[model samples]
Target: MRLKNCHNFKDFRKLAESRLPGPIFNYIDGGADDEVTYRNNTSCFDKCDLIPNVLRGVESVDMSVTVMGQKLDLPVYCSPTALQRLFHHKGERAVAAASEKYGTMFGVSSLGTVAMEEIREKHKNPQVFQFYFHKDRGLNRAMLERAKAAGVEVLMLTVDSITGGNRERDLRTGFSIPMQLTLGGMMQFAMKPMWGINYVTHEKFRLPQLESHVDMSGGATSIGRYFTEMLDPTMNWDDVAELAEFWDGEFCLKGIMSGADAKLAADAGCTGVILSNHGGRQLDGSSTAFNQLTEVVEAAGDRLDVMMDGGVQRGTQVLKALSLGAKAVGLGRYYLFPLAAAGQAGVERALGQMRAEIERDMKLMGVTSLDQLTRSNLRFR
Candidate 1:
């Protein structure tokens, strides 16, 4: 399938699968062991049905929302993922430009291929720097300072990934940072020569965010090693509080899945809490973000913005999360597949389709603004 034929998340995923090598595609598609939560994240939305009203005279619909001090024209923002350049040569640059066009927030991962400073200089939109708390306190402090200097609008510390998940697909394919593809994986890449040509023709692949501190040369550093060796497994609320205090801006905790943790984040001076399961990449049986949204929102929605990401593929899914009191929703694989399919243009198409879907669904729901959506309009099955 070509980009022109892609219409929705599934379509973009198909296109990406066809365009990308198996190992790379599986890296984006696979989840933790058993993959139960991965499938449930999107399916859980079906448990509750949207009860829409009619004759409300919906002429204009506003999808704008303010989460963690950033005013997003749309209710969905791009959650950061690692190593974009491997998927497509445009990398974060393409994602950043598309986000600017749509007037939404974009996040740059600590493992992102593009430099955060360069993305900040190039884009005039709200940007988030998603980083991990390192064992070395000095390294963490320096990364925060760098993001602050780059004028990053949000600081999202991923709290769930103290250790890497058991991604069996990567293990089977032998996929790593400097890809040690198995023989079968090598054959898959050979079939996709176009991807290889583009990958080599573009700027050399480097994790600009961690290159200064981590030595990833000669295939020495795998992501698993990065988590095991560099990241602090003992990170707690106190450490997060210290980081939030230092940043002293829009601070958010990205992997919070419990109401108790949500309350702690609010007390710890976090401006926002994202109820995420690392896209089901870290935990196999953890509750999907949608199922856990109401509890977290009720726990700390008043004190801090409660947002969610994972299994958000359709406009109705976004609306369902918003109706439950999410400040905003996050798009991960929803946009990444399109980026891998056709680079910047593919991303633009996906975002544009999502925007159109949201606006149309808003009118159908008989609401001109997001505030009109609440539990009153929902019924659980």
Candidate 2:
């Protein structure tokens, strides 16, 4: 299907599947263990229904929201994921340009293919740096300093991924930094020769963010090794609190779930906390972000800007999260699959479809602005 005909998240996913190699596609699409969290992330939204108000005049809609000191024209922002160039040659550049065009924030992963400095220099919109606490304290500090120097608007430390999740799909498909394809995986790549050609023709795969600190250029270090060997599992609130004080601007924690944790984020000087399960990439059966939103919002909503992600697919889903108290929602695989399908054009098309869906849903709900939504406007089924 053409980009214009792409109706929902699954449509863009199909487009990406048709365009990319099976192994590479699964790396982005698959989640840990039985993938229970992955399936439920979006499905949990079905449990809640919107009770619309009819009399309100809905002539003009204003979906703009300011979260963590960044003003987003839309209520949804792109969450950072690693290995973008593997999905599309344009990589983070494609995502940055598309997010800027939509006037939203875009995150750059610590493992992003494009350099943070390059994205900062090119895009005028807000940029977030998704960081990981490393075993080497000096390295972690240096990375933060680099991001600070790049003038990133937010510093999001991902706390859930101290160790890599058990992604069985990767083992079966042989997905890695420098792919070591099994026989089955090689056959899958052969089916998509264009992806292989484009991958080779483009600049060789490199994690520009980690280039200075890590020896990723040598191809000896695998992603699994980086997480298992480098990331510090002993990371605690005190450590992050100190980092927050050090960052000193728009600091947020990215993997928060419980009300207690949310409150801790607020107390630790975090401006915001994202209720996420790392796209279900870590801790497979952990509660979906939507399922735990209400409690977390109640705990820290007044003190901190609360945002959520995982399973957001429709405009109504975005509306539902906002109604429940999320200042904004986040998109992970939503834009990634589109980027894999057709680079910048694909992501732009996906964003356009999402915008239309949100606008149409708002008009149907008889609301002119996002703030008009509240928990009372929803009924749980």
Candidate with the greatest TM-score versus the true structure: 1
- Give the lowest summed-lDDT range of ten residues in model 1: 215-224
C-alpha lDDT score of every prediction, in listed order? 0.92, 0.90
Poorly placed runs, candidate 2 (over 4 Å): 220-224
How do the residues 106-192 of candidate 2 rate in per-residue lDDT, one tens digit apiece?
A: 999998999999999999999999999998988988998999999998999998887778889988988865567789999999999
Error of 1 at 371 (Å): 1.1
Residue lDDT tens for model 1, 1-381: 788899999999999999999999999999999899999999999999999999999999999998888889999989999989999999899999999999999999998999999999999999999999999999999999999999999999999988889999998897865468899999999999999999889888888888788776644455547766888889999998999999999999999999999999988999999999988899899999999988999999589999999999999999999999999999999999999999899999999999999999999999999989999889999
How many pairs of residues collide in each model? 0, 2
Q: Per-residue lDDT for 319 in model 2?
A: 97
How many clashes does the backbone of model 1 have? 0
